[model samples]
Target chain A: MRDVAIIGAGMIPFGRRDEDTLMDMLAYASLKALDDAGLGDKSVDAVYVGNMGGGMLQRQTAIASSLVDRLNLMPAAAETVENGPASGGSAVKNGLLAVASGYYDYVLVVGGEKMREVTGWRATDFVATMTHPQAEYPYGITLPGMAGMFTRLYMEKYGVTREHLLAISLKNQEMGTLNPYAHVEMALDRGGIFDSPHAIVNNPTSADPLHLYDLCPVSDGAAALILCPLEMAKKLAKPPILIAGFGQATDTQTLQERDDPTDLKAVTLAAQKAFEMAKLKPGDIHVAELHDAFTILEIAESEHVGFFKKGEGGKAAAAGKTRLGGQMPINISGGLKARGHPVGATGVAQVVDIVFQLRHELPKNRQVQKAENGLTVNFGGFGNNVLAFVLRRVQS
Target chain B: MKKEIAITAYKCKKCGKLHYPYHDRCLACKSREFEQIKPQGNAKLLTYTAIFNLPWGFDQRFLILGVAEFENKIKAMGQIKADSVDQLKVGMKMKPSWEPIRVQYGEDVYGLKFEPME
Candidate 1:
């Protein structure tokens, strides 16, 4: 099989986009990617749309067809992929394979979710639909609840403290203030959020052991990427970031079923597979974006992905190892914590951020110095399903 | 009359790995055949959390939820019978009961509820 490389990457600012419909967001992001590729009215071989809640929230289905028509890209094959929160990553995976297999020369992969269209309660319920229908859903288990339970277990087993979690919250939010595309631009203060008496009102408990700041905000946004063969991408003016390796894995539907709830086996396996395929260990990665839907998740994923030893991820964050300019800068784009997780958009947005880093286009504050390789982990359903990708900057 | 737990656990005939919410095949050995068994005796609290921002269906301000393992090795999610999560602890003994955990369509929905066995 041929190698795949990202030629174009684009995304809109993430936040409460009440004005744009799901279809509109998809179309807009696709157009930006198309223009960025300098394709200038050229048609792609296929279009892959990653979305999770169009049917549930907008009462819309066959979104791929709608997006293709909206973008005036008729006659190209169109398909919509749904993999819970990993929909964006799954769509990119599909596009990568299509191009690598030589079946499609150019593929447009876009992921978007207009979650802000619904109230917070309805959106929470919509996300909870990913839980086990019989065992979890009927019991009203939301994603934060799952994270809260996981956080409790991690604390008990690893001795992770609230200080560790606070470190991630502060670091990511500070980075978010510098990321124009991030949903939350406000930097959090320790006194207002934790140290002061006003902390209770500023950071209330959404789930036990995890405060409001620990969770990503519900958002509406879209991101897109243009993928083609590595050979073709070499002709472009900018450095083409190669999709060197990718991995996806799944675990038991419910957390209780796993032998050890704290052991995110899927995360470990997925990252291992990606690293193996890339022929590079985690230590070789210069910058990374982990699935930090919850503060605790960033810590857990860091350990599972082998960036740090188990039980040390939390401490690593506290010591600033994961911050930009540190040993390994994580979530320079602010991650899901500050960038906002629009489910379907997140996976594509992550790759887009990595592409920006590889291209050396970002301002120094958000860009890693002399970055060469980047990795992304898109988690779904509380660690049950996860996708990992390793991207490398190929000198043009 | 004591109400039954109203839950069926499947034990892999080949691997003896017990599963709740019945899997089509055993996760361990992938055995197709299994024996149905009822959860026996009290349970041990494994992990729990009190969720404040509930979904649309839940009306209460907060709900205490947890996963507990029964004596028969059947693990499941249940509503913890406590005012606050402060009373819950991991590895603590809990008394399991089959009762109404929620209301649906103005009708009582029976499910698992765990009370601290202190």
Candidate 2:
């Protein structure tokens, strides 16, 4: 096996993109990555597209092949990977291995989801299709519903409070104001969202215990990355970010099947494996991006991934330990909370954000000071499937 | 439509372990042979959520879903009966009852739901 490095990363602004088709968004992001790689007219060996609801939402399938054709990169091996919301992470993992094995020198990985084309109810139902057909979906369960239950349990067992959740919402949204590519660019005032007399009317409950503000927005966007063997990456104009380690794990399809409902076992296992392969501990990571589809998820995954001790994640966030310029800053890209979650695009966008941070290309306010390493956790199917990646900056 | 409220599980002939919502083969021993067995009624709730925003097919304004550990310790998820979401509590003992859990295909879909035991 050989080492693989990300030579280029690109992202389109995330929001309700009504003007672009799924293929168009994918092609644009791919072109941006190709341009960033500075490989004018250079051929890519294969293309992997990560998408969860292209068919259901756009009535389109075979996106990878369609994208390669759209970009005039025909004859390249094309495949679409779908692992629910973690599809992007899964695609990158495949591309990483393909390049690492020396079989493919250049692999283009792009993830995009155009969900806003459908109604909110339809999108909610579409995502819930990942749940147990007989046990969960039949009862009208959605991702927010699952997160609400998990949050309630975490609160009772771990002593997490709404105040802690409020801190994450406030911080991420504030950071969003600084991120041009973020879906939500407005900052949240504590008084408006929580302390005001009209708070309940503004941030009504979507799921009991988890208000609307606590959940990520359903977004439409795309992100891409170009991967190649580390040796080839050395000659590139930009500093390469090595894919040091990646791990994927699976749990019971239904959260109830697990012995402990609050425990994200897959998150813990995948992070541990990634750390072992990277030869770096969580403490060594200068920046991190956790799956924050729900604010509680960011908190739970932080602990499960060893960034904080169990039950301490919420407190740590409240204390600004996970904010920019703080000790071990996390979600400096604003996270899924404010950056938006276009399911398939989220995982790749996370890596792209980390790449920017490691390369010191982000604005000073959002950049982690002298960041060298970053971590990302992309969760799928209510923690049933999860992927984690550890990336390091290579000093040329 | 009338429905049975009882919960049925599959017991592996080779390993003697049980499975809920039954699988094709025993996860423990990979035994293909299994026998149907009804789970014990004593149950403890793990966690639950009251979803106010109803999905496409569900008719209820709010759906109360619960995850519970049965006497056999196998975890399962199902809708729970409650007049209000506040009445539901984690770790509370409950008994199963039969009712229409939701409206599907333009008709009520009957399923077993747990209720706080009197």
Worst 10 residues of 1 chain A by lDDT: A132-141
Q: State what share of the real interface contacts each candidate retains.
A: 0.76, 0.64
Give the winner by lDDT.
Answer: 1
Worst lDDT run of 10 residues, candidate 2 chain A, spans A252-261
Per-residue lDDT of A75 in model 1:
93
Over A1-396, each residue of candidate 2 has an lDDT whose tens digit, in order, gives 898999989999999999998888998899889999987788799999999999888888889988988888878999999999999999999999999888999999999999999887788899999888876777778899999999998999999999999988998999999999999998998898889989988998878899989999999999999999999899978999999989899987877657687899999999999999999999999999999999999999999999999999999999999899888788988899889999999999999999999999987898898899899999999998999999999988
Indicate the worst ten consecutive residues by lDDT in candidate 1 chain B.
Answer: B100-109
Query: What's the residue-level lDDT of B48 in candidate 1?
Result: 95
What is the TM-score (0 to 1) of candidate 1? 0.99
Candidate 2 Cα errors over 4 Å, as ranges: B25-31, B71-74
Task: Give DockQ for candidates 1 onward, in order.
Answer: 0.83, 0.66
Per-candidate TM equals 0.99, 0.96
